[model samples]
Target: MKGLLVLLICMLTATSVFAGKADTVKLRQHLIAITGTSQPRNHQHTAALDEVATYIKKEFEKLQGQVQEQVYTVAGKEYRNIILSMGPADAPRLIVGAHYDVCGDQPGADDNASGVAGLLELARLLHNHRLPFRIDLVAYTLEEPPYFRTEHMGSYVHARSLKEQQAEVKGMISLEMIGNFKDEKGTQRYPLAPMKLFYGSRGNYIAVVQRFGNGSFGRSFLRNYKNNANIPVKSLRAPAFVTGVDFSDHLNYWHFGFDALMITDTSFYRNSNYHQPTDTIYTLDFRRMARVVDAVYTSILNL
Candidate 1:
């Protein structure tokens, strides 16, 4: 009986690992598709943005999700937010969002393509999972400059619409930039220098960024995410006044009184290629990126 018990434990551990592992090949394929466009996917490049939105919509549909386009116009030009709703329809929502827009003329791989790739992979992982709450995987546009922090942003439109409709949103997580990491000792930097005392100086960890009083949903997510983390996971809880805390689509959700946090690789603090043309698919680490997605998927399931 003792030997049988030990064997069962080992088998369970192996199964858990295998089940939580994100498909690295799928992650790479999604990244390549998003970054391989001939023109940059910026607001000015409406056609490219539309194409990416369509791709995201189709990918979600392939998972047999109830996908829809949240279309809105900005400066008379139309932009879209692709949404994939799953789980119980009437339950409170748990939003997982990523922007598909890039800044300037860069490929925006780490800037956001990584986040979208994670979103796509998460959709695949969540397809058949039975959960109690509704999960909305959204790919937003106009998170880039000239529209960022503006009402014209796709995230803003979605959040506002949810508010108008009085939808019950439990919390939101923005996969901002989940592909960048560095093992070098001095690769990581923080908004406040004193933070080094707690977080150290390596950019090898994924950060769960939250604001003060992020509410019960945010706290519960942090707990579950840390419990399921495979790679290094560090959380930064600060007020919005702290730089980079509210820099993603989650900020729009916050505006609508929803609890939200961002899961990121610390962006410019670690990724020097941020917003540069060099932020291409080549700069991403797909294996580590898949691990990030795995962590998120398992965490949400545990939730």
Candidate 2:
């Protein structure tokens, strides 16, 4: 009987590890596919954006997700937002979004390929789960400048459509930049000086950035995400006036009074490669990135 109990314990442990594991190999492949296009995946490069969108659509198709294209035009040119929906169609929704467009002519590996890769991986990981509610994994385009805070932004269009349909959106989380990290002291910086005292000076943790009065959905998501996260998870709930608070696609959701937040490595705060040609795949830490995706996956399940 004791021998059988030991065997059961070993089996349980193995299952636990396997269940929690995020496939780093798959993450790397997604990143390479996203960042390796012939031209930079920027607003100016419509064909390159379409290439990335095709890749993302194929990936979602592999999981048999109900994929659709949110097509919109900007200044006579066209763009697309690739959406993959899972779970009951009528159920209230949870949104996880990332922009695929990069700034200027850079690989944008960490700038946003990291986030898009996370979105794709989450779709793969969540495909097998019997989720009780709808989850939308969106790959938005034109999130980069010239469209950043405008109605033309892909996220803005998506949020507006959800509002028009009166879709029950529980909350939204934007994966901005999740691949940058550092162990050295003073490597992290903040918009304000006092923030250093609370958040520390290490860029090794993931952050959840929300506006004040983030609503019930945002609160619950933070609690669940923190509980499930394996790496150090830090969160900041501040007014939008605070720099870096409303800098991503989540801001569009918030504009419609939806509970929203951003999960990031604090872009431009710790990552010197932000918007630079140096923002290549070589600078990313895929293992930790997988952890970020793992935590997000578990958190979504619990939510």
Candidate 3:
């Protein structure tokens, strides 16, 4: 009995260490380094974005995965979306995406760098893992203002093309913001009133939000993530007309009739530094971010 107790304690200790390693400050520093470009406008951050994409591509390639670049021009400036493929090409595809662009003023650490970091980590974790379906890890270019909700939205372009070509996209998941959390109550807010009852005021839980027609996907994802992830999760599905309902890149896929949902930290609602210059890397909780990435990877593989 003593030996068994010792083994259990050791196992718990090892798990705690692994979790701590995943949440290191280095992940946040890496995000800040990438978003800290010379110029925020005029593709000034393009090179930085490319550097991140290159790193992700190389990591996948090292695992013998396939990588593709989808280059597109926006307002006379060039931007590229990096796509990494795992598993058979002919299998049904599930896209996991996050935009790498920042607004002109801020580094966009929590606005999106958090999401990008999560996506990159997810790619690394699932690179060589055998899965039943094809998974595409996409790093999109323009998901912020001037491009958001417009025809030039990178996700809009990609989803529209798929719709036009009749591409077989089973589903898509967008990681908008996943690195900020607060354990205190009343730290979290919502666009609607009734949501306060369903979710806690603490920002520790990851959110799986979808529109009315896409609630099933949100519910399923929440169930899968909650069952597999170490952290808490909350799901919200409302009509598209609800304010702040269509807030992320997932909105584009919904426009194309594809099953899609946004896996977010409820940007602006809980993130105090949503789009400000103060939204730096120091504000995120990378440990929680890593767990979210792990849950996303598991969910996609199972899908």
**TM-score per model over all chains:** 0.94, 0.95, 0.87
Ranking by TM-score: 2, 1, 3
lDDT for 273 (candidate 3) = 91
Candidate 3 residue lDDT tens string, 3-26: 999999999998864443343454
Per lDDT, the best of the predicted structures is 2
Query: What is candidate 1's CA lDDT for residue 4?
Result: 100
Candidate 2 vs candidate 3: the TM-score winner is: 2
How does model 1 fare in lDDT?
0.91
Candidates' C-alpha lDDT: 0.91, 0.92, 0.77
Write one digit per residue (lDDT tens) for candidate 1, span 1-303: 999999999999888755957888999899989987879999888999988888898899898659999988888999899999998899998999999999999899898999999999999988887789899999999998998899998889999998998999989999999999899899999889999989999999999999998899888999998988888999889999899999999999999999999999999989999899899888888889998998899888877
Residue 121, model 2: Cα distance from true site in angstroms? 0.6
- Pick the TM-score winner: 2
Stretches of candidate 1 above 4 Å error? Answer: 1-20
Prediction-by-prediction clash tally = 0, 0, 1
Better of 1 and 2 by lDDT: 2
